[model samples]
Target: MGLPGTIPPAQGPARPALAVVDVQPHLQQPATDRGPGRLHLSAEGASRAAGGSGGGEAVKVILLRDVPTLGRAGTLVEVKEGYARNYLLPRGLAREATAGAIRARDVMRQAEEQRRARVQREAEQLAQGLSALILEMRARAGAEGRLFGAVTAQQVADALRQRGFPVDKKQVELEHPIRVEGFHRVAVRLPTGRLVQVTVNVVGQR
Candidate 1:
């Protein structure tokens, strides 16, 4: 029926639909090109916590020497629950690389480099002074002219102090005691590959 002015009634309810296209570049990249293999994780997800059956966390290891658990510096290695908890984490050798941790690492690395440089310079100065002096040791000897005890690192340090060198006992590396000695080459580890050859003259005591 026609009226003067009128509106029509609603026909049906409206429903919403969602359309999705996978466009994550990180996800599109291959696993091998992404992380330290074995498990496939995107670079973005690698740093964060995992979502697998066994929840594993990422760790950053700084290797001073050749440590077993901590592979090397700048290496992101995954470790099991016990190994990281029992050993690595407690030793101040490694830490979980959260966003904050990564930033802190950069700062620490810079500070460490500066400290290393200062130590190297100090070692160089010590090396230069060590080269100019000769070490003398007086000890009781047998009839064959062999020393009763030996000229050891302590003896070397003592003599060095007497001669005004004042080197630490630890800096001297003696494989064996200087029993039969004339002039021996002692390796003093100095900075920047600088080495000093100090001559030790052992005289027989009365």
Candidate 2:
């Protein structure tokens, strides 16, 4: 028997002693255990991580011809390794701008400049010719001046062709399709970066 509030001893091993369980050391390694430089990436691995092909680095190239949204001929441009390798290099549109390539580009620079000047002069002359020219188009329309069908760039181009001007429909830039009968100013973009406006006189057909 035990006094009040006193714990009685266990009768047998079926109820063993309440000893603290020993905790074994954790087997998992800490992040700090793997120090810096424990793993080094090769050149190929680094290149892949940097979005390059294989182990190849990006290169500087000289344009051999005009590239839309890019530099013109003889201009040095830096591009991705894959683009230089696959597109520009294979198409002969660009080359690695080494000392030799720079020399070659220098030799052709004068000719390219002359060609560009000639194109500019021709575009200016064409713009001047088109300035005074008015294209008349006849379309069926209602009494309120609303056209039965919209006037397209192709129709305007055809009118220009009939008037002895050689122009493609793509050269004409219209903000919207002409849907009314009236005189409207149309803008055309020339290859030499010149913008020319032509008067398109839309009249109702009799």
Candidate 3:
């Protein structure tokens, strides 16, 4: 029965009960079901997010000259592609490691090795000559043995040069300043990593 101006509820077959199909744990849909294509896309996206596509293949270069914080001449090193192209390649400090370039670099490396060996031999000879040398210096001193002024590395190098030894001030290593007038041992580091000890005889000036 329907009242006036009121619609009667339309009647039809009741909705069928939802079938609770017991799905096994393995058969159940995973919470995150990424398909093979999606996984591939995700992996590529991850790689891009990490860096660039070319990040995997860094540029290999041979240094033509010494680069601070990088390497010395004739050194083969890997660097970023952008850095290689922008700075090293443009400045002639490095070249790409191609077949021809590698061959040329090997030749240069051999020549550099020979040059280094020659230099090392010269340094060893110099060190051996300097080992038996003694230097004498005259400085003003007070009643005690202490001098009025300290002897410097430059003074020692100058003395060595006056005696026909090609020595630089930087190569002379003094642990402390020479203030007293006496015999002191000075260490000179040669280019070949040999340490030569020389005796300096210091006397008071009259």
C-alpha local distance difference test of each model:
0.60, 0.75, 0.75
Clashing residue pairs in all predictions, respectively, total 0, 0, 0
Off by over 4 Å in 3: 1-99
* Candidate 3 TM-score to native: 0.53
Task: Give the TM-scores of the predictions, in the order they appear.
Answer: 0.45, 0.51, 0.53
User: Which candidate, 1 or 2, would have the higher TM-score against the true structure?
Assistant: 2
Question: How many Å off is the CA of 179 in candidate 3?
Answer: 2.1
Model 1, span 117-157: residue lDDT tens: 99888877778778765666778888788878888887787
Residue 30 lDDT in candidate 1: 44
For candidate 2, write residues 130-172 as lDDT tens digits: 9998888899999999999999998888888887776889999
Highest TM-score: give the candidate number. Answer: 3
The residue-by-residue lDDT of candidate 3 on 126-160, one tens digit each, is 88778888788999988888899988998998999
Cα lDDT of candidate 2 equals 0.75
At residue 112, candidate 3 shows an lDDT of 82
RMSD of each: 14.7, 15.8, 14.9
